[model samples]
Target chain A: MCTGSEANDLALRVAKQATGHRGVIVTENAYHGVTTEIAAISPSLGGVGSLAEWVRTVRPPSGDGTAMVADARTAIAELQAAGHGVAALIVDTAFASDGFIAPSAETRAALAAVQALVRAAGGLVIADEVQPGFGRLGARGAGSGAAEASLWGFPRHALEPDLVTIGKPMANGLPVAGLVARRDLMQAFGERVRYFNTFAGTPVSVAAARATWDVLHDERLPEHAADVGDELRGMLAELAGRHDRLRGVRGSGLYLGVDVVDPESGDPDTPAAVALVSGLRERRILISASGRDNAALKLRPPLPFSRADAERFITELDGALGDLG
Target chain B: MCTGSEANDLALRVAKQATGHRGVIVTENAYHGVTTEIAAISPSLGGVGSLAEWVRTVRPPSGDGTAMVADARTAIAELQAAGHGVAALIVDTAFASDGFIAPSAETRAALAAVQALVRAAGGLVIADEVQPGFGRLGARGAGSGAAEASLWGFPRHALEPDLVTIGKPMANGLPVAGLVARRDLMQAFGERVRYFNTFAGTPVSVAAARATWDVLHDERLPEHAADVGDELRGMLAELAGRHDRLRGVRGSGLYLGVDVVDPESGDPDTPAAVALVSGLRERRILISASGRDNAALKLRPPLPFSRADAERFITELDGALGDLG
Candidate 1:
């Protein structure tokens, strides 16, 4: 539970070795982890660790999603030309560091587009499924979101990832994570390399993981997450409409981001975010201000959060923001 | 439980980086671990890794005390001439692979002699405390034998091991291990190179370690280990006197190795060792063969074992060996 950083770095290493590439292309506001290799690639957590060479950080697509994709494509081409065998195009879904922003399909497609370019350049594709995995952010019940959103999603795997690294909230601080790759890729990886972690893949952790998944599925927590998320987002958006300092609110499912801004300029207003978090903590809630000059307050609670709980949280947040007026 | 081979290889990477040396000095027949690095140094463990050009194996002295130390000193000189810088001296304590044989004080001092040579050469001293740590094997009543022995007997913080790794029996097969280091050296290692482990310092593991240590101390397992060890050794010795194939036995307190030899030639017998282990296992009493030719049968029981338990085991082993005869 210390961080999701190590697993991300190992993922990069395995991809680099497997694909025989030195360059890693990551999202602009990406916060994959806080390790040297990851931080270098991660624009947000870069200061968290020493950034190394061969990590090409690219802008995660913005409001102008088309331009964002173009920026990433250009960045990938430059790094490839600079002799960095583009290893893997990695993207962190439910980008917590980037205002808890869920990328639009165009943004995701553009990201996927760059990945396609890397694959064309003989690179692998790695997905950071740390968050938004295990059915947290998308469809509520049994139906898959991409499948319901489009025929492509419902029919089969949407983004056929070469490797997937996951951690955080898997077992609610139980500290169990893993990397899932295509069987053939794993076999190739195992040709001469053997990987065994003393702690990871232990029976106890496996039990915890299985049990956590069972608990989540049995309770249908994702549905509850969606309902609560919608409630919380509406409440926060309404509060922002009432308060000029509150600029925006957005997210998918339970993980939401409330962007507080300067009353006069609408520029990222961080002090008010700090004030809100501190006030909320005083009321016995636990959270932190991160993303967007700490102006964006990220709210990610444990699964199985009740709708009433969301209502209560929104009530408290509304009251807190009202005091700012 | 992974193979014993990989464990040693991981240790080697840290050893080299910590010592900043290209050459590793491991005693002959010392089972460092079961990875490529360890297998190459192990003299036996079977398949070897791409043996990096940095390791220099040394012979632990025979018969004469301290000659092992002399051998290590000479080994250091040889390594330097061959362009391998002395990184650290790794000892498996009781070369259990060689019948739980311990280097004499002269040998220890001679090995300790390299302390200066390697230190001047900016090296480290690592003791593989996997077997002897955790008050098992008749160590101190409170802490590991090495910790107790080194803290009091060896010069205070002498050798100042850059890394002292201990595992097995620490959590009673709960899968927990650690490297206790001098705080400053640990800091230096961390500063120079970061080594982060996901499961190494988990909360449950921390609790397990604390509880395990408590059980060892509160139950006086170490004291019992010494008592039962003395009884077991004495009984085995007595049995050896009657059995012609039994040459001798060696060990500290609990962790004993019963040496076997050919009756006619009075030479170490390898076949008897394997047969003896197989015999014991058939009786549902688990014990493994160790030392040269697998000539010594390893007797490592839980610390809480009793004289009655030892007697029962001895009876079973005796009956098994008798059947073999």
Candidate 2:
């Protein structure tokens, strides 16, 4: 794998090969990757009606475990009826594109139900950790205080995914990614097919990944991020109390999302989100908006971002909001 | 693009977007890249019947312009009958996997005719130069001494491909590739889609590409390769005169392929080729075999392969052949 896209693409290939099916299920706003096959299943890239015929989309978990399960069941049935038996259900574990869904018991249960339904349909579960992996969601079983655990750190009892795609922060900047799956599944695919990509597993790229991993562990970056993120969340919550436009702050660790809304109607304010992002850029503190409506301020800084850096970011954000008002 | 696979993948996407068609054409044993969609069009990957429904394969040029043109026409007609309008025809200009076909006026005319037929059906022409680009085929219009020019150095009158994918040697080994297409075709695709790869065009990768280009020009590697390749070709032809198993040597520059055949039948001899490759490896001289039958000794040494190095390779190959006998 050379990128998150390649990892996801390989994962899909493996799932289809292992299950002998073509149907795929993904969240309505999910973004798995940019490859041709992955892009077909990534609805966030091209909105509704852009998906491949073998693909079906379900709403992201919204606390109703039964409804989410029903949605997965329906998607599986639809695919089956269309002659494409269910192959896999892939999702970004952090729900980054679906406005960064908060980690709660209900949300977790919904996800669990969906996973069960997909498995019952003989489909594999793929956790795409391109966004939330590499300690961005904190250490394993650190609990809700650290929010959702990305694939690499997810507790065993929480979810048992068949395949996990990891990328983005793996090699820091060099292109490198990988798909982790059960030995049997990999062996099955390997026996039937040969997979090769130029520049994949290059010595230089692997060296970079090893060094990055060493640095992360040596510096205890995950714990550091957890502590600084908690502080940042509290600061943002405090600011929300002062500003009516600041709806709420959600997400875990350093990957927080701040909702910007219209005070009058409580609707997402895309213009204000745009203004604040531009203002932050003007102040030389870069940030961007995410979510389907692009109204949630996405704050994902370097792993080395410290408490002082958090304070500076909060102060600048506060000033920008005030100026906008 | 971060790799040749990604470049070819992007080229397919752009072609489909620009043409609004689904059908693809490729050589019978062609290997475009490793991406799923590209692999489907690459018949050599999984053999016959593994091609996507929208993909069709044609015989590569075999020095008969009329026959090659007929093959292309038949493939296009079949795809059209299957309701998949022609989208594009992608080929490795070097015919690398097809055993490095010697460039001749008949072969060039055959390729041109195929291009004309594909374009007439509203399909784009994609030149995959991952294996032959970056001065590997020498400067444009250097004739048979230079062989078929790759996209990066193709003479203007040779062929006007609609899109070209370049990689492998672009940045030395830093995983940099690119898709160059007509402005309007690119503009149309960009309007309907957005393409982004995480590590594409990174500063370090671009710096490497720039430095590689500077060195190629400063040392005139293309010209150097052409000169040395001629000397190597003469030596290999002399070897063929001595050994009945050596059928012939073909290709231009350092990308030469020596045909290994059974002395009695004149048919491809894969075992002899394999034995020679292993013998070279044992001597710490690395090389591999190519062609559909894996009977052509692929000698794509570095562009810096000197005359003395060629003599050494030829001497070792002579000894290896003698040992095999």
Candidate 3:
């Protein structure tokens, strides 16, 4: 696999083969990848048609996660009724497009319950960690060392998926991606399908990935992300009190989302979010907005981002937010 | 696109959108790519099931290509009858898997006719040049410089395709691939679908591709491939006259296929092909077998392969063939 899409595509294929079914479940607005099969599951890549008949989507995790569980139950029932039995439930553990939602206690329970429900429906669980993989979603608070942090999002959420898809930060800009699957499931796929990709697992790619892995652990960048992210979030929260449009801040590690809203109405302010993004761009700070209404600022800086860099960004963001008014 | 599979996958989607049809035509044993959609059209990646109902395969181009056209006609009729109207006809111009078939006069006519027929049926023609692209199929004979060479395979046969897919050599070993489509078709696709992929056309990847392109032209590697390939093919032909097991040689420029046959019965000798491949590997001259029966030695050396390297390979191949005897 040379891209996250290819890895997710293969993961779906493996899940389908192992489960002997065709139905797929995804979080609403979840973005898995760009491949045909994976794209169909990614509701965020909207096109002329709805999702394929074999695919269903549940509401993204929020609050107590009860609504999401209800949506999942309905999706499962609909899929079963349609005769396309459940094959897999693929999720981006960070729920990035769902506004980089931080985990709540009930959300954790819902994730575990959803995993069990999918398994009971004869489907595998695929954790797509392309956005929150390779120590990006470090666990413990600011002062904790890298050794104590969870390197991937699924583990942080206590998820034991049958397959895991990783990419993006893999080779630190080089094209390298991979699918990690349970041995029995992979063997089942290998017995029937001859999976192949030209640029996958090449010597140079593997060497680059290994080099990146070495730097990720040796320099303790994950812990650095956590420490700086905690400080950055605290500053953003302080900024939120000053700027009424900055509704809230959420997420963990270096990945954070700031809800942009109308000051009076308190509704999602997509125009304000767009203006804020452009304002930040003018200030030489790169950021984008995502979510159902595209009104949440997505701030996922490089792993080695530091407190000084964070302060510089916050200053610029403060200026940009003032400019937005 | 970061891989050939991605490019082909995008091409298929674009073609389907432009034509508003679902049926796809491909050569038997043709290899498009590994993506879920493209793989369904590639017969060579054998698995448990047949091609999807919307896909139809024609015989690979050979000797006049009449049989191939006949097969195409039947496939078109079948698809139309099945309510899957023609969307596109995708071909690897070199026909590498069908024993590296070189175009005959009739074959060239057949190609032109097929293109016209596909367009008449409201389908686009996609030339998959991952294997035969980047100046590997020079038009003029040996001793000619780079100017006269057709740097791509489709132009060698004077076949105008609506889309062209390229990979492998674009960025040397870096993961870079692309699909070149007519502006009209691209615009049509743009109006309907929202296609996106991460790691496509990044600055570093573009820089690598540009550097490779500069060297390819500055050093006239395609011209070198042509001149060296001409001599290599001539030498192989002479060697074929002496070796009883050597049945015939096909292909042009640097990409060639040598058929291995049982000396007495003149039938394809798959075992001998496998043994020759192993023998070459043992001698540190890596090569592989292709074609439906896996009895054709596929010789696709690096573009800069010189006369001296060809001579060394031939000497080793000669010894390997003798050892087989």
Candidate 4:
């Protein structure tokens, strides 16, 4: 496949075949991709009401994360009652669209529980790692030169996914994406259908991915992101101490977010977020708002962002917040 | 869009919105693309039985082409009775998947009538020009220098399509494809939904398409295809006279197809096509089989194919056919 949507679509198809079911479960405000079937499951694109009947949405794990277990249980029961038994519970482990929640111990446990629950109900687990793969979250390797423990987000939650989808950053702007599935599931689907795409796995695309991977590993970009992200998050936290409008500074590695709210009411202030983003734009910085109400600033800078770049962004953000006032 | 499937999918979305209907009509063996929605309308991928309830299939025009009008009328009535009404009739004007029929005068007139009928019923006509666009059918410009009469297939039939989908060869081999639509339909869909894709219209993709277009025009590749295709067809016809298994040497420009048949029974010979194709591969030539029975040799050479190249191919084909005996 050449796009993330196609990979996710194929993932669901294989999962459905493996599970012998038709229903799917995803986070309420999740974004998978832009293909027809994948788009129907991406509530962030058109809201949950626009989702297909076979798709059920659950709240993303927040706080202690146990609440999402209950949500999944309810969703599973409802799908069972509708006679569309669960085929898969697909998740963007970064939770980027649900306001970029970092996985706490409780959230990880909850995710593990949900994975077990879905499997027990004959559903597979699909980890949409498009956002959190390729060392975007943090260092998967333990030492500077040792073998990496894990570069994928799902491994952190200790969940063994049946299917893992990766895209976008794999080839550093080239169109390349794929679905990595269990051997048994892949064999089963391969026996039934032959898949071929004219633009898939082209020589240039593969070469680009290989070059990017070599550079990423040689430069230790993931470790750099982790170090710089930690430093940047601390700077933002300090800035939040001075700016009452900025709240809830949280994220992992370079993918971070902070809520823009009304100082007096503490409610999401979309206008404030918009104004801050515009103000930053004037200062030659670029960022975007994400989540349901579009009040959380999604600060996913490039993987190679350095500490100096982080300082410049923090400095500009400080001025932008002050200008917004 | 980065693939033809995405472009066709978007075309359908716009058409369905424009007509406020859901039914789609396509040729019985037509192939649009591989996306979920588009694949359902592509009977060449699966059988017509795999079509969605909102879809109807009509036979491709063969002899005089008037028979397709009756098929369209019946399909339109069935869709209306099923309450799907008619959203669009998408046709690959080249009819590549229906065994690559050249546009005859009667078939052209029948297409015009079907277009009128579809419009009168409040449906749009979509020209899927992926196979026949960009001068594949011959020199759109008369006399090699005058402004091109028409570079697209639909204009050759004097049909004004509501939407046209193009892909694959647009940027040579790079991933670039798009949908051209009537202004009002695009406006209606745009007002309701904002479309965005991560890799669409990237600078590199745009540059690639522009470079390819420049080379195509500078070298007069379309005119070359026209000249070479004519000579090639004549050579194949001459060969067909000697080899009973070679029949129906028909097509336009460089996109040609010939039926591989049993000499004694005059029926499609899949094994013979397989053997001929495999034998050609052994001779370092490449070709493929098309049509439902996989018995028609699809001869879609590059636009730059010259008279010399055509002669070489004919020589090999003559030997291959003789070897078949």
Docking class of 2: medium
lDDT (10s digit) by residue, model 2, range B97-198 = 876766678887888889899999999999888888887875543464443343243442266788989988898888788998899999898889867788
Q: Write the per-residue lDDT of candidate 4 for residues A189-282, one digit (tens) a residue.
A: 8886545677888677788899999988899888887889899999999999999999999888888999999999999999999999999999
What TM-score does prediction 2 earn? 0.94
Which residue pairs in candidate 3 collide? none
* Estimated TM-score for each candidate: 0.69, 0.94, 0.95, 0.95
Model 3 alpha-carbon drift over 4 Å, by segment: A47-49, A141-149, B139-149
How good is the docking of model 1, by CAPRI class?
A: incorrect
- The DockQ of each candidate is 0.13, 0.73, 0.67, 0.57
- Considering only chain B, what TM-score does candidate 2 achieve? 0.93
Q: Model 2 clash tally?
A: 0
Number of the predicted model whose DockQ against the real structure is largest: 2
lDDT of 1 by residue, B1-325 (tens): 1212223434555556566666777766666653323544655343223334566656654455355556667778877888878877776655556556543655455555666666777677776667766665555434465435632112222334556767666666544566666677666656655344444556775676689888877887766787788888899998998898886777766788877888899887888888888888888888877665667788888778888999999898889779877
Location of the lowest summed lDDT over 10 successive residues in candidate 3 chain B: B139-148
* Model 4 CA lDDT for position B274: 90
In model 2, what is the error at residue A139, expressed in angstroms? 2.1
RMSD of each: 6.8, 2.9, 2.4, 2.1
Candidate 3 interface RMSD after superposing interface residues:
1.4
